[model samples]
Target: MVKTSKTVGRCEEFTANDVEVLGKAPLYQGFFSMVKYRFRHRLFAGGWSEPVDREMFERGHAAAMLPYDPVRDCVVMIEQFRVGAYAAGCAPWQLEIVAGIIEPEEVSEEVVRREAVEEAGLEVGELHKITRYLSSSGGCSETLDVFVGIADSRKADGIHGLPEEGEDIRVRGLSREQAYQWVESGKIENAASIIALQWLQLNYRKLQEAAQDLPLP
Candidate 1:
């Protein structure tokens, strides 16, 4: 008897044709768009299943950066009123990493840099990619690109954010160790913040060695 490997490992196995979009109608259209979709997808066991109708909330793609100061061993965080938290009976004002939505034709680095200044008043230099994930696939269509940007947290203090945009953000710098404590204590509830801090905890030495070769900004 001969042992053979039968693992299917090609993207061609799954394509847009695999899922049939029967119809889609706009349920709401404002700053964001929501749509009702009637579709059918091929099952992993075999062929297509019955048509399923569901509503999807679309907010497009967004990018978020967690600004860090490897030299200072610190991180810059911001606090702002979050409607989602308020609606969920959590604190409206929650601590989070500096982040913003990527505009049309804008790249990940550009969005995070802009957001860093707007949210934390800190200028981010080099960026290390962390992770990209969907905030919630079941309902919202929000894809987030998370990064850890190198910055000088020594002077990252005071309030920031554009008043016209209804943003009132408070910038606060925390030691790397303290930031991790916040994560362990549930003080840092945002996914982007928690992930970035833990990543820094594990990769701080790598960042430090890389920083030594570059000119300080």
Candidate 2:
């Protein structure tokens, strides 16, 4: 067994240069790719550790947004099928925020806005970034940028998403309180959805205040 020291501070002095990559190669390529990396890093206790091999899933980074209608105090959410959940022996369909991969040359905000339209049939305006996080740093290289966008929830009832992409999304509007309730009840299970909703819960009053002068849609 290995013992480690506990630290009180959040800041670490390690840099990317502290890790040395001896080799790397593609393990598989499909809708997503996997790569194997052999590397060693400087240890917190002392010297460099033994070279290690790890496989990384490379699905690319993504952007997700929760559309909030301040006038109605509602939020737009989407339900869609996710293979990962099915494989994990959980429910196949997931309640989630609008999200999409950030394709090459595209920005995170652009992806969020486009996904809102594609997944929910709703147009979003004035995105406020919530936070950015890694999906799973241990095995996946994907990161997600989360945001809250201004929208008119009355327009968000439909079945949308591109047929060619095998996407079938159901869009619905829920009161902000109701949505946060889902988060508390385990109904909203996905990370992006949970994070976005919690952020909304904490910052919604400020958002409502900021939108007060604007005319209701």
Candidate 3:
């Protein structure tokens, strides 16, 4: 076994300039694409490393929102069929937050609000940003922005989606505690859904305080 250093240096190489992109070749382009890249990066010890080649899946960025009504202490979640999960031999239908891809000219916040309406029939009010992260930097080039949006969760239960987009969604409302239990039970398996719900649990007191009055325009 190789023994590694127990201590590490400071993380100072924090920019694209640290790595050089030698070339990128498109492998496929459909709804999403695959690309091969050749590049090298600065070594932590000091010198630049050798060129390395890798392939990556490229689906554009997306925004996801968990609808919450602090006044009612409830949350909205959705269920939809995920082909990727089906292909992987997992359950084809997944429980997830309302989410949509960010179009080339659209912002994450706009996408989140639009998805809230299209997927759950909720008018997203004040959005509290939870986090932004790469879905899987090792293989996929998709960053996701997560938010908890203020909404009337009691009214958010129904089947809502755009048929033109081939979307069939079912919406459900659960008490905040029940939502978290679903997470712990592994029933809520989507990453964005899990993160958003966990964030709501952590910040619930603040959400209640904010909900005491209507958010301004």
Candidate 4:
């Protein structure tokens, strides 16, 4: 295989197409449909290679919120069960940043705010876009857009979720120090939550100082 990060591939005569399965093999009969998706192409100045077969999947995007209360020096996160992790031999339940899938025709920030309200029951104030990146590039094509949302963490309580969606999310708040300890102890296992907490830990002091400058609330 040729290795290059550039758009141009070394094999000039190469042409590829989406794989289509015409039949299923017996080995994977009961479990999965053994369908081969063939990508037919030729190498530059070389004979045609056998078509490459691979499974295809869709790409998805998610918006996550890190609810931060500068005055209280705390952050909010949610705990929920994840089917993907269970299937991957990991703990089925996980503590994660408030996140939701970006619906069709929906804006990223809107998704973040909606998720925060639904999962944590907090009205978002200032929203700071953190960063966007692929969650798992090797197998999954899922991109995550993360944000830091300012909110009142002290009053955060109650079980918040859309009953119609069968969501049983537990909303919880943690002090900056406690959150950092969780990160160090490997307790905040979720990637998005950990990243967001770390970011806040690095900037929490500055945020607290700024909050002090404001008039008494």
| Alpha-carbon RMSD of each model | 5.2, 4.4, 5.1, 6.3
Provide the clashing-pair count of each candidate structure. Answer: 0, 0, 0, 0
Q: Which stretches of candidate 1 lie over 4 Å from their true place?
A: 1-15
- Model 3 lDDT, residue 115, Cα: 89
Error of 1 at 29 (Å): 1.3
lDDT digits (tens) for residues 87-111 of candidate 1: 9888799999988887899998899
Q: Which candidate number has the best TM-score?
A: 2
Q: What is the lDDT of residue 209 in candidate 4?
A: 80
Name model 4 segments beyond 4 Å from true.
Answer: 1-51, 212-217
- How are the candidates ranked when ordered by TM-score, highest leading? 2, 1, 3, 4
Q: Using TM-score as the measure, name the better of candidate 1 and candidate 3.
A: 1
Cα lDDT of all candidates, in order?
Answer: 0.85, 0.90, 0.87, 0.74
Full-model lDDT, candidate 2: 0.90
Task: Give a tens-digit lDDT track for model 3, residues 1-217.
Answer: 2123344467554356667888999999998999999988777876678999999999999999998989889998898899988997777999889999999899999999998888998888899999999999998989999999899876777788999989999998989999999889988878998999999989998989978887622
Can you list the residue pairs that collide in candidate 4?
A: none
Residue 177 shift from truth in candidate 4, angstroms: 1.5
Task: Tell how far residue 4 is off in model 3, in angstroms.
Answer: 26
Q: Compare candidates 1 and 4 on lDDT and give the better one.
A: 1
